[model samples]
Target: MFNGLSVTEHREGDDLLTAGLGLGGLQSMAPPAFADATAPTAPELRRRAIWSNWRGIADLSPGGGYGSVYGSVANVPGREFSALARLEGARYPHRVLVQVPDAFDHDRRCVVVAPASGSRGVHGAIAVAGAWGLPRGCAVAYTDKGAGTDYFDLDAGQGVSLDGRTAAATAAELAFAPDAPTGSAGVRGVAVKHAHSGDNPEADWGRHVRQAAQFALQALDEAVPQAAPFTFDNTRVIAVGISNGGGAVLRAAELEGDWLDAVVAGEPSIHAGATSLYDYATQAALLMPCALLDASLGPLPQPPHAAQSVPQWTARCASLAAAGLVEGADTATRAASALAQLRATGWTDAALRAGALSVGFDLWRAVSVTYASAYGRYGVGAHPCGFGFAALDPRMAPRAATPAERAAWWSDGSGIPPGAGVGIVDPLMAGPDAIPTDPTFPGLVCLRDLAKGNGGDALRVRAGIEELRAAPPREGLPVVVVHGRDDGLIPLALSSAPYVAMARQAGRDVRFWQVGPAQHFDAFLALPDYGARYVPLLPYVHAALDRVEAYLDGTGTLPANAVIEATPRANGQALEAANLALPR
Candidate 1:
């Protein structure tokens, strides 16, 4: 048993004697540590015990956001900080950090912060805890959703290498077999592996996120008693997150709403398949051809699709154009000419005759232009597929020029196809060798379906507000959703707007606020001397948190749902006012 060991024994700088104890060993040691320690109270002992367990597994030094503006609140006076504590997650142990201000209101109010997707785990949540939690005198807990370096191998299986002739042959075959199952003929599963074994098959990404939130809340409950000098009010717990984290909080609310007082999401990545028409159109135009080629040729090739016969290629392009999804006369002309050439000769002959790869790049540009023009007309943002797709393709990682090349190549209209009234093509052609043309298209569609439980996995993870309205309601819990009107990464219309409407229609207490002139990652840009900065949205986030805290405290009225024109100030703060022109 873990006797005589106090939880507070391992302070901020203290080293543990039993650092080698793995998760299993640690679990075997001692009871709950709720018993009184020889040196101090039982709560203090429990805190130290938990800290030791956490530090033994992961680094808790304030390195991630410590030097950045987001961690600036660490300098605030009268704030007590705790080293990250390891908590039991759904499948494995995860990390959590707690912060309590000296002037804590003793109201038992706590805030749980989640990070954005692709973030370096708990590091992503540190700033929010500092900026939004400390100043408000609320206890804060930050948790990583198993995306940290310790939980996932960043470098493992992240490359596409075809060395042997057999492997190369399999790659070539897979390239053409669109319906081929993932993990077949060396196809890699894009889903990153968890740190621990025995993963629950039923737990999709959303379920994992919900479980992480639950663990954090449980850790806070245990840590509060030990943090006696700085009391924490845990009764009013609010979950807040941005981007992927935003979606997580929504799911957490849906799964554990009874325990939460409020939920706040900013530019949440939700409703996966709910992309705009323009997004689907552009993605189809760019990826369909690449997918076709990639399937025919391995990751690297001298000439691809030379032997393959793609008789339906032209027909597909024609279909899109006919559907009015493709715009611009120049683009239409190019599509037509490309189709005509395909009909005259097979994909191989046409490719060799016209430099197929370059032609594909040209088609990408033309289609992208049409998509962009349509985006502006429709007032929707471009799908964030460029980044998402790059992450999926390991080749893009080694080739630094790949991402820039993709952006520039698609934007510049150099390789337009010449012809008249070209017919459109269907990106998702169905059956064998079907082209996946959507931004949300999973390369290993079959694998995704198997892992996610169905084709609606992405939507399920997003936990869209509209979808939530149809679920069993969590009575009395209010939700405040904030979005940046200028966020091209996750457009407001496709994400938060629909949820707000759904909640209102369901008679749920939901408020939506759109912040203009602010884009995703605005808060990160707030850091002084941060290179390549954009408009900072930290001011708006802070304001939103303030409003949420007020609502929780029953001391202020919720602002009417509307758009706020946010103007960035010279001092890095944003000036926000109600925009009457925007529809509520």
Candidate 2:
């Protein structure tokens, strides 16, 4: 089932949870250094990736409980087994890693299946699952769910090894080696698996999770022959995750029940009801800049640079008016019209206000563009909108990635380009940035048009969107879900609330907890206004896992489904346990 599998042990301060950075290193904004910057070893890449992914996914603020509350980056001695595991006939390999801690109990065998959040690398869940499971002596199984950070630079003839090594494009069985064009310009751009693999990988997230769990049991048995016969019957297998990882475990539960005992999903980016991310994200990409201008929203959180973008947003409003997407005689009226459109499209009042964070960070454009390719199954450089990814020169034009950039692709990339220095290429938007007239506008229009399902790209994207909604988990699987009420990315109304209702109606055991004043990005909580206005959801994620485990262990009953009404740590005040209002 596995190819080129290898095992190695790590101990003595170089641990599983923090990769030897300890709490201090993770807190630092700068990345860990490779002794050889141009060519990082597989282990070095792994450590830096862990640090990058942990900071990307979780809030590590001193006030938000880095050292005091739950984060303990102490040395966790363990053996790690990793390899390129593939689905039947799959063109791309999904990477899975199983970490077996030395403290794992032969009798109290447990395995935690944690798929990566979003399109992150296999370490994406290091913050949520690794931090929680490694200390409890549970062997943690992690998969990128077929979408990983194995990037390809067609211009440089370079791609990445599954072990995080830089390799030639022709190397066999690299995680994602796309078909390079004969003429360099034919494919002279960066390629990302999630957007360019033509796999529509989201369709197989459940199977990927199942594969990780299977590998976990096998690896655990091999790591400790004394526990050579571990199986689901004897060992407790729980699935825990957040964001896309959260959606994956829920999908796994639906695909199979017996192997998965219980599920704890936090702010899952699921499609259960009337809305899908592509539908809303594309809309937000077009409308949010103008929508944020609504006077009712007042002075919400925004970076200092957001003020500079006001001219771009004003230009966006004028362009929308010209295109008839909104109606107005002036910017303020057009902004109000944009706000109404958001409400009409199912965005709630809370989400509208909280969306300022994503808007400020320019996430709406990044997400809409990435998912458009995934859902439409568009291959590298084939985006109907003429969107492409490449490393930018000082001139901001596309250029080949540097050797140092290639070395860190696996460690620093978010499994999507237009990041880690690979910016998006839009043919219609001139100067890329020097012109600076809302360069995202043209690409966003193309994505929004594709959402309408008239052309071939639109039809393909809609079909893929249909495949995203997995049925509620089968009866007998107990589920505990925790969602932040104000989540703008995957709003509660669009995702969790409807899924919970459907799951209960289907007779599946499910408990839902809604935490107010909590938004989607826990990592964003470390930001200035964000720290003041939002509480971290990771603590509640751990809490939900605890409830599900206690119920599974017969030590306690499942917490009743209820609203948490969590308090925000406003005005620079430090966060407290009371802020969570965790279900007891």
Candidate 3:
């Protein structure tokens, strides 16, 4: 194996290599001088290419199917049953789980569910659809959002394949086959797979979701051929999503408002321009510097060298304070608090655990907390420096750039090195009087002007913010947005509140619900052993969904804008509405 060949290749009657040369003996034999040896084989490269393009993996288990849905076991009790539907389009082919009731009224509606972060592709949408859509005699389709597969695939056509498994049966086979009775209800829906999960430099989050929404519409159109018993009401199709998925749906509503009848965004992480700059900068200052420092200078303070390391971090804090990014008085205090926390718990273990949870934290709560705390400060105005600092800090110093070296790098006016990640500060710095000068912090102006010519970073950041901020809901299109008042991750004030205000200002038919004491994951908490500590907010979520469905069905009225104070039972089963207070 070390020689890149199996023992079988050299075995002669089990003797191995030349006669009587076993695996150990073969090590002593030198290769022929004339033999041509190369690196990776053609087959290996081909295998990698195939794996990279593959979107969904095949599941051959008795009940298993594409995108984590099991046809046999995933069926809801008596009311509804599920089957995997393959939707092939010109650009992409996706498999979604379609759940329909045993029987339904002639005017049944269709729902498209977008899965949340960390959800198991189509499997995650099952519970939400079962509780919300299936009971109403609605045909619900749950989208994977590419959670179980490679979400980064640019070419949507080359998705992973799930073939030849008993559980991998198509929708036509289970629901729309000619032999099946037309009287029995069949599902007409599609699950959309997200293009890219993360902040890919190539594409923004808003653009990716817009494309996914378009793909979903195409998928629904394709479902028409497979759905015989059920006539999919595309005119009344509603999109529902939670968390990151909720943000995607909101973007979809903005980009594809004409295609959607209504949108339900629950605890959405909406990006609202530069409003989050300060908070984002604070997090960068608090979390990033230490990690970068530790990476450069071995394990923070090494015994006798503790004093030497303290000054470097102090300088970073001082820089922020001088720039008026952080409160000058609190700089030392905050550093002390962080250092004390670090000292109480050693770096290695805590860092390892933190690193494990950091992905989820950064994606969900990091920026939220940053915004909350930045605005929470006594009297800090809009400071663009924070945004500048957050972008430049990571690349400001090399792993070997010590405290003294950084000081020189900043002082010499050499600017960021050629290969440093794009700097946004430079363009802002180039404009006369772009960055206000502070008498106390003499270095602020120099730091601001460091990236004078590099405008790419600034342009990207600005464009991203503008793209992410959803356009006001289209006229006559009803939008229902539910936000938890106590949501610490993506605060209601920063995300939904502003968006709601914008929508109302534009006279869009929109309803905003503020549920008190309900955290972001409260609905998921209601599930068995899901979130034991959080008070369940699923009942309120159901209430909001009920309103959305009613409005779509044209049978009921939506409540006026109001704040609902919800009280939860200890068992996470029930949520009581204590009071409904109208927004003043």
Candidate 4:
């Protein structure tokens, strides 16, 4: 339940949809700035936070059809309600925010409850739920689902207020307050809620999603007092989210309730009866670099600035070979062995091919290290792989964050570190500064062993994984799941496909839309070859949402279960509606 609530209404140039930044501002090269870098106001934090979220969550670049196509940032005047929802006796807080556009209809009330994708702040779904629902006068409900940019700075003894400005850790209702930083982590450090909360927060994502919807109804009762009493029975609630957010809605469906009328989940990272993120991410962190060396994959996206980047992934091939993981005397043979091993594990060629993009960014380790700690329920400074988070110095050594940098974390930090200037660190590294080497091979190997081991840490991790699996969603619930064939991060074969099959086999109504030439990340669609080779997945997500909305409204039926063969855009060509291949 909510501990407290704060409300603010937006009018004039400032509106709910874009956080006062219209399409132009959102499409700007940089995010909106804080007036005073060292001492930002709450409103400044909110606006810039929304701007940062828009870029991370949506593809706002020239080709992906944001403003000109499916989405719009047209000012929708509305009142904003923010609150923290927490289980009893917990320091970590999950945010529930409601945006009630002025156009909200009392006669036909609707709410789109979308949890934040990945580990983002409250506005993370503004690109999806906010864009789609606000214009139609439906309130948008967002929850971090127990993960967010509510960073706790151990060095400064500071956390963030609900509005995201820096505040003392001792302050009342700080978003997060981890156990006092201890155990000699070797550098001034920061803590993220998802990894350090010690609560195995993902285990409770379903509860948090339900709480967000509950809060949305309470907020609406106060926002439109004239309408008074708006309960789940009378008001329509459509739940939609992507990635982690998507998994949350699916979890919510498993609960026995009518609070959610329909669900549209895209690339959901749910651990059904198949491969969980931990099972694959650690494998990816260890073998992807070696696998990328296979020339047969052909022009796969390597890490940005590969020619200039350190860590020499070629060293990774050597490391894997030496560890007896892959059988090969040289890089080429080693790469083939790695690719063969991945295929034997049931990974599709498209998934491995698309995964090179994430491999380049080191996202596999980023996700693995974070999730490993979360699953093991490790507190701050106790990462099983010896990983820590901190702002980096010029030489890439961990350092205390500057006031301005600390002030911007709420808006700039990606919920996960290694973003917003704060990076993953190895406190156990012998040198004063950690140097990039062999792409952090030892750490990845350690994580992989934990996955296959049965130690205390492994037991904890597997136990948490068990908690994340979904039972069949309650009968009579309708669900539309959309996943891209090219999604390497959370591969379609490993996640959505099996879950949908099981739910339907249990006699639940679940629609599956597997889209080709589409990938997990719409934001990455702006990249050069990425834009040319892959279609954005969000448009299909929107199509699913539209169809479900019609079904709920009695205007139409749900789309059939089938693959949608979308077309890749030509090089230098603007994305067009014809490329979507959405079912008629």
TM-score of each: 0.49, 0.97, 0.48, 0.96
- lDDT, candidates in the order shown: 0.38, 0.84, 0.37, 0.84
- lDDT, ranked from best to worst: 4, 2, 1, 3
| 273-344: candidate 4 lDDT, tens digit per residue | 667889988888888888877888877753355574324667888888888999889889999999998887
Residues 1-584 of candidate 3 have per-residue lDDT tens digits of 00111111112222101122222222232311211122223222212221211111111211111112211112232211122333322122223434434332234536445443222333343333334664465545454433323111111111123311111123312111111122223211111122111221111323333333443344334444355333223434566666555665676667543566677777776665334432332343343333323332234211213355445445555555555544535545544444443333223222322221222233222332222212222111112232211124463321222222221111111111221121222233334444243121222333222222245433433443443456676677777888777564455666787778777787887788787655654323423332322333344445667777777678877756767764443443332233223232
What's the C-alpha lDDT at position 538 in model 3?
40
Q: lDDT value for candidate 3?
A: 0.37
In candidate 2, what are the lDDT values of residues 1-584, reduced to their tens digit?
A: 68878798888867888888888889998998899999888889988999999899888877886556655566788889998788885678899999999998776788989999989999999888988888889999999998889888787777877688888866655888876562455577788888888888888888899899999988987998876788888889999889899898888889854888888899998888887888988899899888877788777765525657678778889878978999998999999999999988778878887887677677887887888888888887788887888888876678778889878889998987667777877776773432366666777888899887599889989999999896979678888888888898888888898898888888787888888888988888888788787778888888878887888889998879888887777666677777777778
Candidate 1 residue spans exceeding 4 A from truth: 1-72, 76-109, 115-120, 146-191, 194-234, 272-473, 523-535, 568-584
Alpha-carbon shift of residue 212 in model 3 (angstroms): 6.8
lDDT of 2: 0.84
Task: Judge candidate 4 at residue 230 and give its lDDT.
Answer: 85
lDDT of 1 by residue, 469-514 (tens): 2221255666777787755445566567666665666677777878
Ten consecutive residues with minimal summed lDDT in candidate 4? 427-436
Clash count, one per candidate: 26, 0, 8, 1
| Candidate number with greatest lDDT | 4
Candidate 2: where is the Cα deviation over 4 Å?
A: 182-184, 304-306, 431-436
